[model samples]
Target: MQVNNDRLTLAVAKAPQIYLAGVIDADAPQRFESMMRSGKIANGSDIYLNASGADLHAGIALGRLFRQGSMVTHLGTQRRQRGAPAKPALCTDACVYAYLGGLYRWAPTGADRIGFPAQMAVDPKASADPDDTSAYLKEMDIDQSALAPLLTAAHADPAWLPADQLIAARIANNGRLPLTATYQVQNGEPYLTLAEVKRGGQHRMSLECRRDGVLFTAYNAVGAEHAKQIVAHGARSFVEVNHAESYPPQQDYATVQDDAVVIARTYPGAQLGSLISATTLGAWVRDRNSMLRYGFEFELGGLDHILRKYYQACWEYAPWQVAKKS
Candidate 1:
């Protein structure tokens, strides 16, 4: 059932993606659940929402259902045809609350928008129970301060949140959440550490300067059995730079600790000298016995600049004439 003013609809698209459009009402969550139970919505599907407003309570409920299903949320409407592109969409008012429910929420880009209506426009029931809204935000893992702009906007204007601000405030997690990188001094040596946790798993990669070369350490969370199999059967692991395999002649080995598989490899400075200008870095592991291969690739982008700073810091700390950095 849908409200008279706006008819909410759910449209299943290709595998791992679905479209949810129109206004939300008390029955919206029920409609979504019915589709989910009917196997129309696959696990961890990317749900594109084009909702304008909602019953505040119903939107909160729908958001909870999204989190429970481990879904990814984006801002887009259903395509016009089977293979047509999705139309950009806006999520405003109570609809914004529902978007927050996604485990991995993508920020609205370009013409897409996420906005909060002027105070006078908000539903009376929603404004009356500010506590409910506060509680919903907290439950969604959003900090109260993230909604400060929404709260302080002029009474006559809607508060529009940009893509960058949504990400910076942690209100919207672009793709699979932001990657965090930091520099830390360990054992009197400087190291560049980066980590990101998302739906698939956790990944931690670090770079440190060594006398002979740059040590790259990658620790990824894998199942206990898989980790054992990798260590016992001996897996072939390699590092890729810009889609090209660039490791030294030394074979890479894996160790299992803390339910994670870790590999440490040192690449000569001259070989990795172009790393700062490279486009991507990938860590790959292949089972020696079978065709199973798993890996993760990271785009350099901002990381390249970070690597430059790390190289300079390494030189300042332990100046060596030999080129020995990655």
Candidate 2:
């Protein structure tokens, strides 16, 4: 076993396989290309074993290739510190995306599964846009419905999707077929870009999270009608929280680039001259998932083009609560 701290590396065995573990860093693209050229991974001959679960700021383009490198088997702890106990296999952040590279991918249930390993941890700070994953699922020829369950399962800890679910989702198209002699993992769908109108300088947003809950305020000079328009547009576009009546969102402008989150909106109300949105990210709102509140604001009429100023408070998450690690 070879230990290469934190970065992606291959554990060469006495066979024709390369075992990979650790974070896929920014340099992973070049490294992966080198390996593919050097015959470390091949279409029909080599199988890649992955245990990495973090991205370490890796780019999405690099992640695409790393995922397509080979058919991957989620191995738990084949290589570890001396005399250490076996660990649960985890695939978080971009590592999970890379796992999609397989002509055939297999994940063992860590403790409860028969035939395959029992449980694999898949928790990570993930994208908020379901479409981000839905697009990829389309390219992989997998059902888009699989994404919701995967995200929900990976909500707090490592996860294992039932093989039955994968088959039904068509992610396991060939039914646990590990070696596909002539298969090729295709490129995933490109992220979408939509029309955007920035807030210009008319609106100002602020956030403060307390023990009771999080408070968000947006002061807009766009008037009451403007606030209503914002809410109406977001209701049709942004991913609604629970019901449109209870938790209203105003973010529907753009998809975040990475783990970057959008910090906007709340229970926005029109005041004397400004529009304010407030909500509690706690049980006070009777919502357990209310710990983090976010959304976006689109200023009306030429906010971006007329004034030639564009500023939208998108991609906002409480930094103190998150630790991006392996």
Clashes of each: 1, 20
Model 2 lDDT tens row, 188-269: 2111111222212132333333222233433333345544444333322232222232344454342222222222334321
What TM-score do all the candidates reach, one by one? 0.56, 0.36
| Model 2 superposed RMSD (Cα) | 21.3
Clashes of 2: 20
Q: TM-score of the candidate numbered 1?
A: 0.56
Worst 10 residues of 2 by lDDT: 306-315
Those runs of model 2 whose alpha carbons end farther than 4 Å from true positions after fitting are 1-15, 45-63, 66-70, 79-87, 111-133, 153-163, 172-326
Q: Report the alpha-carbon TM-score of model 2 versus the true structure.
A: 0.36
Instruction: Write one digit per residue (lDDT tens) for candidate 1, span 1-326.
Output: 21111223323332366667888878888988887787766567777878866487788888888889988888877566979876778887668878988988998876887776554223233444533776677678887664665546534345777777777777887755557678877887778887778665788788886666678888777767777777677567877789998757786767787767777788765544565456877777778888876667676665656777777777776676235553
Candidate 1: which stretches are off by over 4 Å?
A: 1-93, 106-175, 233-235, 321-326
